[model samples]
Target: MRIVGISVLCLFCAFSAIVFFTYYRRNSATFSYDIVLPTIFGNSTEFNTSEIKKKRRAFVVNVFASWCTVCMQEHQTWKEISKRTPIDLYGIDYIDIEDNTLAWLQEPDNPYIAIAADYSGKAAKAFGLREYLKLLFSTKKVNWCSI
Candidate 1:
């Protein structure tokens, strides 16, 4: 009985430690702007990571899909933020159709100064983005915007 009790306690502690580590790892993950992806622009332009890094201006990279309700809800807030802050806003359309994304932006205001298409989801994967809506901020230190 004593041996069984000890084994159960050890298992519980191990499980708890795993949960804690996973939570910490997920929340503490950081994203960098060193990635370069093609833009949605007609000019065949791309998101110039080197230029952005050189400028060192604080900017926001919003990863969203046209079909995501949470993203749509946050769109207004992004527009408001753009008006108030000097930060440049960019959008990454994650695993979405370009036509749908364009049509969605047409009805509402586009807060993004530039838009990129992540049709293959590689950009999203590279950034370690697991959520439908993720806002990455490029500053002196790279961080994820909670809002």
Candidate 2:
């Protein structure tokens, strides 16, 4: 009788822990962090990271590679999202050549509000990207004319 009671209590505790973890991981905003630079791309005269962040209420930083086929596939979805939504889009041109990135921007369906070149991968690394592949979200006022 004593051994059976102990087993039941352990089972109950295990189930409780699983439920708690599931709720926490799915709903918590642990992965979202404020980006340090606002407009990190293009000619300095055209866009500046610090300036854009100050002007826009919220923005998205997409970590992408020019050669990444998955990133390529996601481009259309991103384009649609940009056109339909009020959200500001920023690109972290992750680990790609300057010329290739330039050609990518020249694509018929350009969607980025601004592009930041991250050749050294330091910015993405600072965002602790390798820890996990998660999408970060934030909310801010929209300035539609800027786009």
TM-score of 2: 0.61
Query: Following a full C-alpha superposition, what root-mean-square deviation does model 1 have from the true structure?
Result: 4.1
Candidate 1, clashing residue pairs? none
lDDT score, candidate 1: 0.80
TM-score of 1: 0.72
Model 2 residue 69 CA deviation (Å) reads 1.1
Q: In candidate 2, which residue ranges exceed 4 Å CA deviation?
A: 1-50, 131-134, 141-147
lDDT of 1 by residue, 62-110 (tens): 8999999999899899989988889988888999999989888885556
* Total colliding residue pairs, candidate 2: 4
lDDT for position 51 in model 1? 65
Off-target runs (Cα >4 Å) in candidate 1 are 1-33, 42-44, 107-109, 141-147
Residue 50 displacement (Å), model 1: 3.5
